[model samples]
Target: QDEVVGLAGELRSYLSLSLPEHMVPAAFVVLDALPLTPNGKVDRRALPAPADEAYARGVEEAPVGEIETLLAGLWSDLLGVERIGRRDSFFTLGGHSLLAVRLISRIRQELGIELTLAKLFAQPVLFDMAGVIAELVEKSGRQLLPAIEPVDRGGVLPLSFAQQRLWFLGQLDGMSASYHIPLALNLRGPLHRAALIRSLDTLWERHEGLRSVFVAQGGEPHVELLAAETGFGLVEHDLRGVDQAQTRLTELCREASDAPFDFARGPLVRGQLIRLGDEEHVLTLTQHHIISDGWSIEVFLRELRTLYGAFLRDGEDPLPALQIQYPDYAVWQREWISGERQALQARYWSSELADAPALLALPTDRSRPAQQSFAGAHVDIWLDPELSRQLKVLSLRYGTTLFMTILAAWASLLSRLSGQEDIVIGTPVANRARTEVEGLIGFFVNTLALRVDLSESQDLETLLAQVRSKVVSGQDHQDLPFEQVVEIVQPARRLDHTPLFQVMFSWENEDVVAATKLDGLSVTPLETNYEVAKFDLDLALREAGDEIIGVLVYSSALFDEST
Candidate 1:
C-alpha cells in the first residue's frame, strides 16, 4: 500500500508539469494489472473507485471554520461533487464563467456581502474565498436588500423591465416568432408518454410564467397568471409507419418553432412529441422570449429531468417548492429600482455611451432596406484545439479572460472591415445577479453595449485591456434595462437597425448548451434552423472539448453565402 501510494504521488507530480490544471486528475489509483474484457478491451465497469485519501493531496486542507464550511458546501452543491477540499480550485473542478457568476450571486444572497468577479477569480479556493467573505461581512456596515419572498397573488403586477421591452417589440413586430425560445430533444428508449405529459403539466403548474400571458390593462402591460389547470397540450404524432419520418419530423418542428405567439391569448408555451418508432421519440418545447431566456432553458431542462425521474420511479418530487414566482420578481424589480437609483444608473449609461457610433456599417452584398427583413442564415465556424489553446495562453499573458481576448479580436476585425475605429457591440448578460430570481424562468437577460474604441495601430494587449475594462464597467451598471439605456442615449432610431448597436456577441459555456439526461431514455438535443435574425449579425460561441464552435447568424437579406 505504501509503495503504491508513493508511486501515485510521483505520477501525479510528473503529470502536473505537462498537463493543464483542469486536466489533472483529482484522484489517482494504481493497479497491478489492467481489467480487461473478453475482447481485450479495458473494462471500465470493473475499475475500482479511487479511495478518499487519493484526492487528499498534501497541500489540501479541510474547511477550518463556519465560513469555510459554508463555502465548501456551496461549491459542492454547484459543482455536483462530493466532499470538496478547502484547497480545491473551483475552475480546476470544472467551474466556468456562468458558475462563477452564480457563486457571487449566491454569496450576496446568502451572506449579504457583495463580491466581484475579479475577487472570486483572484481567490477561488474555499479557504481564500472564506477569508475574503469574512472580511467583507465584517466591514459591511450598510443594510442589504432582503431576500425575495412570495408575494400575495391577488394584486395586479406590472411587467419587469426586460419583459416590458419584449412586450413593446411584440406590439411593433406583430408576433414575428423572432423572439421564440425553443428546445428540441431526441429521446430513445422505452418511452413513457403519459408520464412525460404529467411531468410537463406539473412543470407548467410550478412556474407561473409558463402558463401566464401579458394582458394590456389601462394601456399598460400586466402579467395575468393563468390557472393551474392550464394544459401544455402535449400533442404526439405517430410517425412510425410514415414515409420520410425524419424529414417530416424536421418540417413539423420547424413549423411549430416558427409559429407566432399572441401575448393576449397565450399559455405562451408549446410542446410537441413525435414518435419515430416504438422506442424513439422527439420532443420540442417552445416558449415566447417574454417568458424565458437562455438561463431559463437550463432551469427548465433540469427541473424536467428531476420531475420525470421521480414520476418514473414513483417517488416524491425531488425539487423544493419555489419561494417566489416570475410575477413576484416583476413586482419586486419595479419597487427595487426607484427614487434616485434609476437616475443614477441612467446617468452612468449616458456618460459611458456618450459619442458612441450608431451603426457598425459592415459592407453587405445588398443595400439596406427601409425596415429589417429579419430573414437570416447561419454560418458555422470552428477553432481547432491548437488555436484555442494559443488563445487561452494569450488571455493569460494579457491578464484577461478568453472571452475578452476573443471579443477584442472580433472588434479588431470589425474595425478593419468597416473602417470605423469607434465600434459598439451588444452583448447579453444573465442579469440574474440576485440569487432569488436565478432559478426562475423569465426574460431576465439584459443587453450591454460594449463600445470598443480602437486606434488604427493599437496593439493586441492594449485593445484587450480596454475591452476588459469596458465589459467590467458595463456589467457594474447592467441592472438598467437596455431599453432605458437607448432612451437615455437617444441615438438615431432607424427602423433598419437596433439602437446604439447593430452586432451582438455572446459566449455560452458547454454545460449550458449540453443536453440533459432522462431516467430511462437516451437523450440528445436537436438543433433547429430558424429563418430569422434579431440583429445584423449575432456571433454565438460555445466550447466543446478542446475546440471552440461558433455560429455566425447573419441577415440573409443583406448578405449571401459569399459575403
Candidate 2:
C-alpha cells in the first residue's frame, strides 16, 4: 500500500510537470489483480474506472462569496482547470511569472481593479488574494488603459536603448568580448540533428530580432532586417574519438564564446554542436547581448523544445503564430516613450534619483584601468535552508519580498566594503511590463539604479523598510529606459566605469521549464566557463527549494582572488 501511494504521488507530480492542471488525473487506483478471460488473457472489460468519490477526496471547499467565486473562475480559466478551490496555491497549480502577468492583466479587464505582481507573490492562494482584491475593489475602482496597437514601420528601424549602448561601446573598443551571451547544453541518448536544425530555422524565421543587424547611417545607429535567406547556420564538430572529450567540449565552448560578432554585417547569433559519443552531444548557443536578454533566452529554449518535439513526433510544426514581433514593440516603444506617460515617469525618476552618488566606491585590490576591459570571474555562494527560511519569514513580517530582503543585505555588504553611507546598486528589470511584449523575444531588459542610504547603523528591520520603499518607487518608474535616465541625470561620465552604479544585484524567482525529453534522449543544462565581466561587481540570487544560491561576478582587472 505504501509503494502504491508513492507511485500515485509520483504520477501526479509528473502530470503536473508535463500537462495543464485540468488535464492531470484527479485520482489513481491500484489494482490487486487482473481478471482473466477464458483463454487466460487479462480482461480489460473487468477493470473499473476511478469513481467521483476518489476525485472529491482531493478537492477543497468551493469558493463561497462573490469575490471568491469570481477569482476562482479566473484562476480556473487561466490555469486550464475545470474548477479551482479557494485554498489551492497558484504555484502548486503550475502558475509561473508569465502566467501571473496574464492573470493580472485579465483581472484588470474583468474586475476593474489593478493588481501588481508583488501582490500575487504575497498572497498566492485563491482565498487570500480574493480578499485582497475585494478590499481593493471596495476602496477604489480602477481600470487599465487600452493597450496600444503595434505600429508597422515598414522600412528601417532604430536600435533599442540597450542595443544602442552596446553599439556605441563596440565602436569604442572592438576587442571587448564581454557582450556575448553563451548557453551550453548536454544531451544524452538518441538525437536527431536534422530536426534540431529545422526547429532553429523556424525560430529564426519567426522572430525578426534574430535576423537583425546594426548599421551606422549618418553617424547614427539603426537596425536593418536582412532577407529571410540570410540566417544563422549550425557548425558541427565531431570529438567522439577524442580521449579528453570533456576538455575538448570546453575548448569548443570557449572558441564559440570568444568568436566576436560583426554587428554591421548580419547574423549576430551562432550555434555549434559537438558530438561527444553516439549517445552524447554538446550544444552551444552564443548571441550578442544587443539582440537577446535573459528572458529572451528562456523564450528561445521553450520554443525550440516545442518545435523540436512536434517535428520529431510528426514532421509538422505545431507552434502558434506570434501575435506581435520584436520590431513592432520597438516601434511602439519609440512612440510611447515620447508621449505624456513617459514624461510623468521621467519626473518621478528625476526627483527620486536627484543628487544620487555617481558610483559605488567598492574597494579593489588592483588599480583601475584607463579603458574598461570588461574581464571578470565569479564565485558561488549558497545560503543554508534554515537561514533562507528565516529570511522569508522576515520578508513576510516586513510586508516585503525575498528580493527586497536580499537587496537590503547586498546594500549593507557594499556599505561595509566602501565605507560610504549612500550606495547605489543597478538591477535589471524585464521591462515586459506591458502584456503585448510579454511573449516576444528581444532585448527588453532595463536597468534600475536603486540608491539606498546606509550611513547610520540601523537594525535589519529598519534597513528592510527603507529598501522596500525604494524598490516600490523604483518599480513604479521602471519603464523609463536606463539610457534616458542616465541622460537625464547627466552623471559624471568616466571612461573606466559605468554610469549611475558600478555594482549590480539580481533575483530570479521564475522557474523556466527545461526542454522536454526527446525519445530515448535526456537533455540537461551544461555548466560552461565562459567568464567575462560586464560590471565591476554583479551578484545574482536564485531561490531553489528553501535555499538561496548566489553567484558573485567581479571584474578581473579590478580585483584579485584574495580580495
Candidate 3:
C-alpha cells in the first residue's frame, strides 16, 4: 500500500508538469499488476475506479481559524458545495468572474478588508486568500466600512452618484423612454389577480425606490418617498374578445414600455395586466432606470417568487426586514466618497485614461448624424460547440476566465478593422459591494471603461494576459462612479458621440428569468426586445449549454443591415 501511494504521488507530479490544468488528474491510483485477459493483454475494463477523493482538487486540509472558517462557509454558500477544504481552488470548484466579484464583495462587507480581483485571482485557495486578508487587516489598522442604517424619512435625501447622472440626463432630454426597464411575464395557468396585486403592493411598500420620485427643489435634485396610503395601482386591460390576442399583447407591452414616466408625479414603477384568455395572461412591469438596473431585475424576480408562494400558503412576509433603503445608500455614498479615498481613486483614473482616444473609429456605411440617435437593431451570432469548447480549453491553459479570452479576441478584431490600437469598451458591474444593498431594488450598477492596446503583434496568450490585467485593475478601482471618472479625465466633448467609449461589451453569466410558481400558474419570463441602442455598438454574449449566444446591437443610423 505504501509503495502504491508513493507511485501515485510521483505520477501526479509528473502529470502536473506535463499537462494543462484542466487535464491534470485530481487523483491517481496504482495497480500491483496488470489485469490480464484471455490474450494475455492488460484489460482496461478490469481497472478499479478511483475513490471519491479523485473528484477534489488535492488532499483535503480542513479550515483552521476564524477567517478560514468564514471563507469556507461563503464558498459553500456561493458555489453550492457541501464541503470545502483549504487547498481547494475556487475555479476548480466552479467559481467564475461573477462569483469572484461576489466573493470579494462579501469579504469586504463582512470583514472590512478591501480586496481586489487581481488579489483574488492570485490567491484562489481558501487558506491563501485568508492569509492575504489577515495581512491587509494588520496593515490597514482594521478600519471597517461604514454600516448602512436606515435614516429618518423626514430628513432630506440626496441622490446617489449614478442616480444623479440619470436625473441630469432626463432633465436635459425630457425623460426619454430609452432608459425604461420593462419586464413582461407570461402566465399559462390560473393566476390569482388578488394575490399578484398583493405581492406587487407588498414589494413597492418594502422598497422605497419603487414608491419614490425625483423632484428638483431650489434647482437641486432630491428623492421623495411616498406614503404607503397611496398604494401601487395595477392597470387591467381586458383583451379576451380581441383578434390576435397574443399579437396585441406584445404590442401593448412595447407601447407601455416605451411610454415615458413623469418624475415629478411620483411612483416611477408601473404595472399592467392583460387578460388574453381564461387560463392565459400577461403581466407587464416597467420602471425608470433611475430607480432600477439589471441586477435589480434578478432581485425583483427572486423576491416576487418568494412573496407570491408565501401569499398562496397564507404565510406572512417570509423575507427579513431590510437594513437600509435606497436613500440611505445615496446619503452614505455621498458622505463616504469624500476626502483622501476619493482623491486616490480620481488620481488613478485620470492617470489611466490620460491621452486616451475619446471615440472609436468604427467603419460606418452612412454619414455621421448631427446628434446621437437611439434607433438600433440587433444581429444574432452563435459560436458552434466545437469552437466554444476550444475557447474554454484555451482559457484553461492561460489561467484566465472565458470573459478575458473573448474580450482579447474582440479587441483584436476591432483594432484590425478600425486601424487603431487603443480600444476602450464599456462594461457594467454590479456595485452592490455592501451586504445591506444586495437585496435592494435600486440603480446600483456601475459602468467600467476597460482600455486595451492591441498595437503589438503578440500571441493570443499574451493578449489574454493583458486583457486580464486591465480587467482586474478596473475592478480594483470600480468604487468611483464613471461620471466622476469622466470629470477627472476631462475628455473632449462632442454632441454626436458618447463621452469615453462608443463600443460596449458584456458577458451575462446567467439569464434573467422570472421563474415562479403559484398554486396553479406556470410562470415564465417573456423576452421583450425594445431594440434600443444606448451605444454605437454593443456586443453582449451569454453561454447556452455547449455554445455561445451573442447579440450585436448596432445603431441603424450608422450602418445598414447588410453591412
Q: What is the number of backbone collisions in each predicted candidate, taken in the order shown? A: 0, 0, 0
Give the TM-score comparing model 2 with the true structure, all chains together: 0.80
Output the better candidate (2/3) by TM-score: 3
- Residue 260's lDDT within candidate 1 is 87
Instruction: Report the backbone clash tally of model 1.
Output: 0
Model 3: worst 10 consecutive residues (lDDT sum):
52-61
Instruction: Extract clashing residue pairs from model 1.
Output: none
User: How are the candidates ranked when ordered by TM-score, highest leading?
Assistant: 3, 1, 2
Cα lDDT, model 3, residue 100: 91
Q: How well is each residue in 164-194 modelled by candidate 2, as lDDT tens digits?
A: 8889878978835688888888889888888
Could you tell me which 10 consecutive residues in candidate 2 have the lowest summed lDDT? 51-60
Name the 10 consecutive residues with the lowest summed lDDT in model 1.
Answer: 52-61
Candidate 1 residue-wise lDDT, 1-563, digit = tens: 76665454456567768965434555677778989999999886688887755663423456788888888888888888787777676765667666778888787767777787777766766777888888888897434766666777778777989889989998888888888877789899998877788888888888987877889977798888878885667888999889998799989999789888889888799989998988999999889999999889899888988889988877777888888998888878887777697888898899989989888899999998999888899998899887997887676566566788889989988988999999999999999988778788888899999999888677776788798788767776777889989999999888988889889999987555356898899998887766678898999887787789988998998989778
Give residue 48's lDDT in candidate 3 (0 to 100): 81
Report the error of model 3 at residue 304, Å: 0.8
Which structure is stronger by lDDT: 1 or 2?
1
TM-score of each: 0.85, 0.80, 0.91
The runs of at least 3 residues in candidate 1 whose Cα sits more than 4 Å from the true structure, single-residue gaps closed, are: 1-69, 72-96, 118-135, 142-144, 243-247, 511-514
- lDDT of the structure predicted as candidate 2: 0.78
